[model samples]
Target: MRRLTIWSIPIDREICAGDNLGDLLGATGELADGDVVCVSQKAVSKAEGRVIQSDPEHLDEAFEAALAAETRRVLRVRGTTRIVETHHGFVCANAGIDRSNAPAHALVLLPEDPDRSARRIRDRLRFAWNLHVGVIVTDTFGRAWREGVTDVAIGVAGVRAILDLRGTADWTGATLRVTEVCIADEIAAAANLVATKAAGTPFSVVRGIDPAWLAESSARAIVRDSARDLFR
Candidate 1:
C-alpha cells in the first residue's frame, strides 16, 4: 500500500531577513529523503531582500518608471498604477510588489532568481540534515480563465516539473492526447491545502508521491514560454 503524509508545520515566526532556513527547519524535525517541502514565495522574497517601501496611495514618477521598465504590458490602470506582467511571464499587481503582511513602509517583491533560491535552500537542507528532499517555492497566482486563484510553483529543485504523456499509449492501447500533467502545479495546490494564507502556515511537506516523478528539474519545464503560450 502506498502511504502519504502531509504536514503543515508552523515556523517560529514569519520568515524575515537574516533568518537561516536550515536552522528554522531543523528545529522542527528531520527532513527525510524523497520529501517535498513547499515554501511560500513571500517568505523567500523576504529572505532575499526583495522588499521596498512606498505609499500605496501615491504613484510617484519614479515608481511608474520602475514599473514600465519591468513590466511587459499594463493590464489595468487606476489612480496610482496598475497590474502588469513581468518579462518572466508572471502577472501581478505592480509587478508582484506587495505591501500586505509586511513591515510598515515596505513592499515585497518576488525573488530576483527564484530557481537559485530553491537550489540554495535545497542544498542547505541536504547538507544540514543529510537528506535528499525536493524544494519548491510557491505563490498564489490568478488564472486567465479561472475565477479565483491557486498556489503555483515558482521555484523548484530535485523534482520533475512535468509528467509528459504525449504519444503514450492509453489503457485501451490508443495514443493519448494532451496528457501532460503539471506535476509541480498540482503539488503546489496540494501543499496549499495545508499551508493556508490567513493561518500563518507558510510551509508544508508532501510525501508519498512516486519517487520516479521527482528528478532534478527546473520550473522552466512547467512555465510556458511566450512563443509557445497559445492563450496569449
Candidate 2:
C-alpha cells in the first residue's frame, strides 16, 4: 500500500544566499532510503540569491513592449496586475516575479537551474547522513482549469518522476491508458499538507512509497518538450 506523510519543520529565518541545505536538514534528523524531502522553491531561490528589487506595479513602455513580444500575445493586464505565459511555457503572475515572503523592496525569482539544485541537495544529504533519499523542490502553481493553486515539483532527484504504466494490464486484462502517474507532483502536493503557507513550514518529509520507483534521475525527465507535449 502506498502512503504519504508530511512533517512540519521549523525554519526560523529566511533562507538566504550561501546557506548549506545539507547542514540545515541534518540538524533536524537523519534520512533513510525511499524517503522524499520536499522543499519550497522560495527558500531555494533565496539561498541562491535570486531575489531582485523591482516595482512590478510600474512598467515602462519598453518593458511592456518586451513582455508583449516575449509572450507572443497580449497578456492579461488589469491596471498594475499582469499575468503572462512566457515563451518558456511558464504561466505566472508578473512573469514569475514574486514579492511575498521577501524583504522589503525585493522580489524573488525562480532558481535558474532548479533540477541542479535538487541534485545538489540530494547529494549533500547522502554524503552528510549516509542516507539514500529523494529530494523535490516544490512551487505553488495554478492549474489551467483549477481556481486555486497547488504545490508542484520544480526540481526532483533520486526518484522516478513519471510512473509509466502504458503497457500494463488492468484487472480485466485491458491495457492502461494515460496511466503515467506523476509521482513527483503527487509527493509535492502531499508535502503541502504539512508545509502550509500560514504555518511557515518550508520543508516536509514524505514517507511510504514503493521502493521500486526510486531512482537517481534528473527532474528534466518530467518536463514535456513542446514537440512532445500532446496537450499543447
Candidate 3:
C-alpha cells in the first residue's frame, strides 16, 4: 500500500513583499523528487505584494471599494456578503480578498496569476536543488452547499490537477463510469491541516506523491468552463 506523510515547515518571520520564496525554501532542507510543496496563498500574496489598505475606522466603504476593484462580477449577494467572479475566473467571496490576517488596515488580493506563480517557484526550486518537485499554492474557500471552508489549489505546477479514471474497472471488476479526482485541491486541503491559524505555519511538504500523478497542469483546469457552468 502507498502511504503519504505531511509536515509543516515553520516560517520564523512573516513573509513580506519582495521576499524570495526560493531562497527561503532552500534554507529549510534538501528537497527530493516526488515531494509536493504546498504553500498558503496568504504568503504568496505577500511575496507578490498583493496588498491594499482599508481604513480601520471607515471599514465599510473602504472594504466595499476594495472588493469592487478586485471583483469582475457579483454572482450573488446576501446581506453584506458577496460572491464574486474574479478576472482569472475564480468565483469566491469578495474575489478572495483577505482582511483578517495582515497588519492593521491592510487587505490582500489573490496573486495576479497563480499558475504562473507556481511555475516560477517550481522552476526556482528545480534550478537550485536539481530536484523535480510539484508546487501548489492554496487558499481557503467555501463550497456551494458546504457549511465550512476547505483549502483548495489556486495555483499548481508539476502536478496533476485532475485524474480521470472514468473508464477504469473497479475492485469488483465493474467498469467505473465517472470517477475523476481533483488531486490538487485534495492535496491542498490535506496541507491546510498543518498550515493552520495562529501557528505561523505557511508551508507544508506532502511526501510520497505517486510518480504517475506528477504531470503538469494548472489549477484552472479544475475550474468549470463558463459555458458549461450550471450554477452561474
Sort the predicted structures by TM-score, highest score first: 3, 1, 2
Model 2 spans with C-alpha error above 4 angstroms: 54-89, 228-232
lDDT of 2: 0.75
Candidates 1 and 3: which is better by TM-score? 3
Q: Estimate each model's TM-score.
A: 0.88, 0.84, 0.95
Q: Which pairs in model 3 have colliding backbones?
A: none
Candidate 3 C-alpha lDDT tens digits along 1-232: 8899998898988999998786687678856788999988989999999887666787767778788888888999998779998888899988898888886888888999999988988888889867788999999898898799999999999999999999899999999998889999999999988875887888899999898999889988988888899999
| Per-residue alpha-carbon lDDT of candidate 1 for residues 1-232, written as tens digits (9 for 90 to 100) | 8787887878757678877665566567846789888888888888777766666555354455567776887777777647677766776667766657877756677777777788888888888877778888888887766698788988888887888999999999999999989898899989988875676777789998889977888886776776787754
Candidate 1 backbone collisions, by pair? none
Q: Which candidate has the top score in TM-score?
A: 3
List the global CA lDDT of all models: 0.78, 0.75, 0.88
Better of 1 and 3 by lDDT: 3
Instruction: Arrange candidates, best lDDT first.
Output: 3, 1, 2
lDDT for predicted candidate 3 compared with the true structure: 0.88
Scored against the true structure, residue 112 in model 1 reaches a CA lDDT of: 77
Q: Answer with 2 or 3, whichever has the higher lDDT.
A: 3
